[model samples]
Target: MITDPQGTVLALFLIFCRIGGCVMAMPGFSSARIPMQIRLFMAAALSLAILPVLWDTVYPTVHTSSATYIGFIFSELLIGLMYGMLARLYTLGLQFAASIIGMMIGYSQPGAADIFEDAPESSLSGFITFAGMMILFMMDFHHIVFRALVDSYTAMPFGGVMQMRATLISFTDTLSSTTYIMLRLCSPFLIYGLMFNVAIGFINKLAPQMPVYFISAPYLLLGGLFLFYFSVAALVSQFGQSFASVFIGR
Candidate 1:
């Protein structure tokens, strides 16, 4: 049986390894603006908080060799990073869809205008990024994310087997699903872009001299924006469901 102090410290170290790795890549904690010291403290605090609950299962013989210890830490860090990146990738689908839709609508033009920030938006890409972030916060998706983080300990135990091949397959499938989701989410705008452009082509053939392309721009923008606004609620609902399914692995 392990002594209380040794087991406690070991568990804390392992948990913190995971937490630190995760915070380094996870979206909310991994923002470029957050100070490294703050992130380190937060990870340490989380590890400390969870140590008692995990102490029963986390005991492992300490490696005397420096190389072995480094290997263990690296493996644990890799596992944590994998989970964090998965979560971040899943959430990014919304932003990707928004960008695609905006681009199709011609709102993705570079330096056309600025919305939430001073940086110019190409076609409403900036707006999409901003809106996606807002929706994430407003929906309280972070709570689910925290829950997923806690559950990751159970799913992937400290010093667990790597299962690299399976992980690669799972990661690939997740990425594929993300791409499909983005395409499907933005399909309305794609269709609108196609039809609007086709109509413009016919008008150009008929008028020969008129600036049909310029005239078509307003209609495309209006149609795309109308579609986006009308579908925003449904799109968010779909995204929330998809997000939950992706992270919680339903």
Candidate 2:
């Protein structure tokens, strides 16, 4: 059994392992733009907050060897990483959807540049990725993530069985959901793209020298942008709802 200060410290370390791992892998908190000091501060704060509540359940005994302690730390880190990956995957869904939309609208240039980050995403892809991240912040999705972390202590107490398989299943399920939503989100663009291309094809067949491809470019872009602007609200709402449904297991 764990003793006074020994158990408390051990619990703190374990919880910090998971929290730190999450901070390292999550989006807003894990972004390269965020300072390391801020991330560490948040991790420390969260670990301190959870130490008391989880100590009795998760705290390993001080009598254990250093290797055992290391093992416990690894366990905590794994759990945190799993959760963090889920969040990151959700963010990627927006990028994937944007890529699809870009392709449909003839904007799927492979090497376009952007200022927000190092990635060289197409314009529409970049816009979608930026918008999704913004929506997460605007919707207070981070708070919900924190809440989930807190609740995790209850559902998956420290030192409890990690349920690795179940976690993997959850991760895969999130991936599938993300893919499905992304496809659905870009369905309108896909349809429009098909029709536009078919029409352009017919026109080209009639007047082979009319520069149809060149002229159609501007119309395609304007139409895609207009549709995206109108659909922004719906897209954000669907993502938030999907997030809750998956993370909260609803």
lDDT of candidates 1 onward, in order: 0.72, 0.78
As a TM-score, model 2 comes out at: 0.87
Lowest summed lDDT across 10 adjacent residues in model 2 is found at 54-63
* CA displacement after TM-score superposition, residue 76 of candidate 1 (Å): 1.0
lDDT of 2 at 167: 90
Off by over 4 Å in 2: 1-3, 60-63, 108-117
Best-performing candidate as measured by lDDT: 2
Flag clash pairs in model 2.
Answer: none
Query: For model 1, how does the per-residue alpha-carbon lDDT over 1-250 read when each residue is reduced to its tens digit?
Result: 5456754665578778877888787765676557889989988988778766766566553434556656667877887788778777875676578777877887746565544334454656655655665676677776776666677667766565767886787688778887887788788888888888888899899998998878878888888888888987777667766766666662
